[model samples]
Target: MIAGREVAGFSDREIADLLAPLRPAAPDSTENATRRDAFADAVWSCLVEPGDATAGVLRLALGPAAALVALDESDAVVERRLTDAGVPDPSRLGLAAARARWAPRAVEGRLRGAFRSARVMGVRLVVAGDPEWPGGLSDLGAHGPAALWVRGDPGVLVSGPSVALVGCRAASAYGEQVAAELADGLVSRGFAVHSGGAYGIDGMAHRAALAAEGTTAAVMAGGVDRLYPAGHHDLLSRVAARGAVVSELPCGTSPSRWRFLQRNRILAALTAATVVVEAGHRSGALNTAGHAAALGRPLGVVPGPVTSPASAGCHRLLRDGGAVCVTSADDVRQLVMPTLDLGGDAGPLRLPPEQLRVLDALSSRRPRDEAAIAASSGLSAERVAGVLAVLELDGRAVEGEGGWLRGRG
Candidate 1:
């Protein structure tokens, strides 16, 4: 029993029915244990929010079923169980705080409702050991999702090589065009595209990949049962028909701002690389890029006109040496398959080390005189002047009345 309700009330027959979509061919001998574990994971998906490291630790230490039972035990017993399971420091985990956050949603009705909604919507719950699970997600460690709610062929998620194309929701025409071209080109080379199911660049990528008849998955912030951005209903439906629409949350969960931010981590972890096609200085896509870099996944960006604010984030990434400049599908392919040489250069701008330092010192919004540029870039004045001249000839920088700024190329 848990949260004033008897666990026995949720019959094994009902649990098996709810999981039928994912367990079509399970052997009878192992079905009981499999059903119990899957049901526990489903309950865990409801008890904690996305990317809850504490919950992840608990689930890993106790296993989903034993962890759920721990919620009903006294704090001392729970801590002992954690210790017995080899947790490094059980007290530091703040079980009391975790329980406080989880208590409100621990009702049996909530669990039943989630399962009911999933069964009605034909959503499949996929736990970590499932064959359909994406192996790449293991890289997230304790911050990864405990289970996934999927609405299409879960096989598409584990299919071949995948790249994430993410950017600002309010993308410009040029941004959308480049996103489509990259998506189409990557698909033709046998790569699945992944993106958030949002408007602008994400929409363009999904549409282009589908037009090329390639697999593409939309990782949503909300429940797989409720596709957010209502306008993309038909598009998302089409994606679920051919690929998958996925979320870490269970059915009936609504999308929130925090959930959207947490959702970006999953997108970064699920693919070999992430590309920021277009982003403003404050675009949320930068959040995804940060995750990719932290995970040691290759990050790529598409450069836009220097004067366009829409490309400011991409420029920032390049200038900071946080991402590689990739303008074509071949360049992206190289990122995923580093050893597969494509003959000559893939056409990314390969500036000299000194020139790149000078470019990094130049500001897009504020002009800096040669002495100031030299000081910031840690280069000699003579070298700075020469590099500035070469940059000017290449339309990479422009001198104004007082100083030089990044060019409008």
Candidate 2:
């Protein structure tokens, strides 16, 4: 039982129905254990708000089932359990504060309702261990989502390389045109496009990608079933038919101001890079850029006319050296996959075999000494040093205080 509700018969039936679409053909003897964990994760999705680090820590220290059980136990027992699970200082995790925050939303009836709604809507529950879960999300650590409620093909979330194109909802004509061109060119180059599924730049991006016959995913601020911004209901439906429409919240939850900001983090984490097509000084697209930079993902911005207020935020990013200036799909591609060629009329940006190996060995987050890079790329220190100099000049790599690191390009 979970949250004082029995997990047998009715509850089990609903969970099984919701997860049926994602289950593998090969049956396992531990089916009951899998069901229990899935149920616990589903309940966790409803109990905590998006990006709750304390809850993330709890879920990490104890498995979802054990974590849920700890909620009803005494504080002393909970602390002891956390200690046993290798937490150095359980009190530092703010267990009291988390418990207070979660108490009001711990209704078992609501939990069951979310499951039924998902089942009826054909939404599948995807947890951390699932094959369909995107690997990039692990970077968010404890602040990552507990689970994802997906309304379309879960596999699309992990498909190939993807870039997020975002901007203000009230985009200008110039901004929309730029977004559409970028999306079309990116999809033609074999990249999937991701966006917020909003009206302006986001809508243009999704539509262009679809028109080009490429996969595109929309990360929603509300529940997949709610499909906020009702005007884009048909657009989101088309995206779901071809790709995926996903959220961290359970079914029936409405989009709130805070939730929209939290949703930006998922968009940043899900893609290899984030490109702000156009944004005002306070546009929410800038919020997504911040999250991408924080995650060590490459951030690109399209520069608009200096006189245009719609692009003030983008110009700020460029002037501050926080993001690379990307005017075309080729530029955005280099930001995410620096090793790939630009192809087409621009010709391929080819590198020597040795240089390519060393470039591949470079880390974007950690700086590596020449010797370490040499060892990884199977090259001598002398050859590595020479290649590093060329890469640095090309803006494909940088020499940091620690050693060498991948550049944003």
Q: Which candidate is the best by TM-score?
A: 2
Question: Candidate 2's C-alpha lDDT?
Answer: 0.84
Instruction: Provide the lDDT at 42 for model 2.
Output: 76
Compose the digit string of candidate 2's lDDT tens values, residues 383-407.
9999999899888899989999988
Report how far off residue 71 is in candidate 1 (Å): 0.8
Runs of candidate 2 with Cα error greater than 4 angstroms are 1-18, 21-30, 344-409
Question: Against the hidden reference, what TM-scores do the models get?
Answer: 0.81, 0.83
Q: Rate the local accuracy (lDDT) of all candidates.
A: 0.84, 0.84
RMSD of each: 9.1, 6.6
Q: What is the lDDT of residue 299 in candidate 1?
A: 83
Candidate 1 steric clashes: 0
Q: Give per-residue CA lDDT, model 1, range 186-295, as digits (tens).
A: 99877899999899999999999999999999999999999988999999999999999999998899999999999999999998789999999999899999888766
